[model samples]
Target: MPQAVRTAIVGTGHRAQLFTEGLAKRDGYDVVALCDPNSVRMAFHNRMLLAAGRRTAHLWPPARYDEMLRVERVELVVVTSVDATHDRYIEAALRAGVRVICEKPITTDAVKAQSILDTVRETGGSLSVAYNYRFNPVHRRVRQLLADGAIGTVHSVHFEWMLDVSHGADYFRRWHRDKSNSGGLMVHKASHHFDLVNWWLGAEPHTVYARGQLAFYGPGPEHGYARDYVRAHGSSAADDDPFALQLADNATMRDLYLDAEGEDGYYRDRNVFAPGVSIEDDMAVLVSYDTGATMTYHLTAYSPAEGYRVMFNGSGGRLELNVEESTFTSITLRPLWSEPVDHTVDHEHEGHGGADPRVLAALLDGEQTEGAEVADARQAALALVTGLAANRSFETGLPVRTADILKL
Candidate 1:
């Protein structure tokens, strides 16, 4: 039997739990230590581990991450930290000669992203950005169809992603409301969609133009929402607000976020319509790919539904995929001039349409099923730069070249 890969998770947030719990069920991967600034969050994760029938991992503060890595002899570091902090941990792990599996977006801005790319180039460290969307069975099938020339030479793509009040409001209520922390939804959320386009088309972005606005979740009476307390918990004003997420309502949320709030002062339930939120809730982007393919994508967080519709226009035919998360419609794929086919997407596992488990298996157990895509630092950097350039376009109202932003 192969030796188990000793791993350390840098963040103990909700996303980190997916990897930790999934790793517990898999062989040849042992989560040895957890690194987070908040001890309470770490404790919650420890309790989660115990519930999963796995041994509790040693906890280390973020300041002692390097020491924890050295002492634990961690072979791989999984970075599920904040968007702005990903580059720091990634670069440090590379400098320490440890492998890394970082979550999507890689980093919030171009400078940090470029730094990570430089570190990867300098150290030749193993780094994989976890774009788990590519691991979804239906999405993998889409990749397979594209690879098989079912769509022929792709010329253009149109993607629209909608996040309903439940999911979309969550972003506004957290650190993601600040562009400094999350680089807006364009960088933080659209990275996944942009990467899917890059991966499916087998190309990189060349130019990007975008427009965005904070129409939904910022301070403005124009949005038609009355003023209220900042957080939902213990607030009478938020008691009747459907958009407010009561962290105390869900045990998992209560334990993970509400209980940990005292240590970090991080409230899980902030008013989505409160002032000081910097991120946009609506955005549209136009991208030109190196393969001569053009893409028009829009992301709206304050939507009535949560799902996406992506259409690929190719030389031979067009392939369209429609997915609605909260409905019974499932995933439907249609090729132009053919009957629309319904694909029963498996939601048996948690996280992003069952992509998390497959991603974890690939990252930890070296299990690469057919059609699974692994994005390296370079690929991740390209995807991130696309979004960053889009954001710049949104600000400057000019088409921004990915190369100019990347300085490549």
Candidate 2:
């Protein structure tokens, strides 16, 4: 058998654990080193590996990333860092002649995204954006149906994504509450939805107009949230607060975040209704695609349910898909027929509806699962620019052209 690919992962956050643990179970990949600014988080990851009976990876500070890459002989760098920091690691890996598999949104802004694209072009580097939703069995089936012309000549699309309190509230509690960190939910969360549309329709966005607001998770008396503490870990306000996530409550969370809080002073449970939170909780966008297809999309972070409803209107007929992801309910597909078909998709795996494992397999082993396509730099850039254009539109209150935002 061929030697395992030497890999290094930056950012020892919750997401990084998924990749590390998944790689530990596979043979063709070896996680050699882990880099992060906080050493406590790195220690937590090592502890996790030891607990799982896997070899603990060496840890390095963020400043020593280049040294780690060279000394560790890392062939591939897996970036699971914060959204704003993704471009930095991606550029470093490309410049070092190492391949990269980065978590989505590419970067928080247009300049960073363009910088990454430029570095990729300059270094002739290979980068794959992990848009794992494409690997979902139900989503893969949709792609197959679309490819097979189940809905001939797609003309328009309407997508609505709802994030329930458990998942959605977590975003506001962490670094994602700041636009600089996560680019708000538009570029951060909506990247997944936008990429799905782009891949499913085989088109890129041309123009975007958007409206968004921070109606829920911010300082507002009208929101009826009365909280005095900034963080929940040792605060009295969090004792019985439903909105507060006590890191000490769960063993895993305690070890990963609560114990790791000393190194970076990064609190995992910041008040959701705290002041200075700049990201929007509700958004509506209109996009025109290069393929002449128009899309109307809406994202609500605080919702009663966690799922999405997407409908593709075609010249021949319409294909509608509604997924309630939280309860593992059946995914309903209505093909403009009198009786629509309902598919009970049991992924029987964890993380992003079993897409995470498939993504890792494809990246590490070159394994091609159904509907899984390696997302290149250009495709990732287009999807990112689309959301960035929408963000620009939201700020300027005008329709923004994707080409202008890209300026490629």
Q: Cα deviation in Å at residue 227, candidate 2?
A: 2.2
Whole-model lDDT values for every prediction: 0.86, 0.86
Error of 1 at 53 (Å): 3.6
Candidate 2 at residue 141, lDDT?
77
Clashing pairs for predicted structure model 1, backbone only: none
- lDDT per residue, candidate 2, 52-168, as tens digits? 677888999988898999999999999999999999899999999999999997899999998999999999999999988888887887787778887788999999999987789
Compute each candidate's TM-score over C-alphas.
0.94, 0.95
lDDT of 1: 0.86
User: Which numbered prediction scores highest in TM-score against the true structure?
Assistant: 2
Off by over 4 Å in 1: 1-3, 328-350
The CA lDDT at 18 in model 1 is: 80
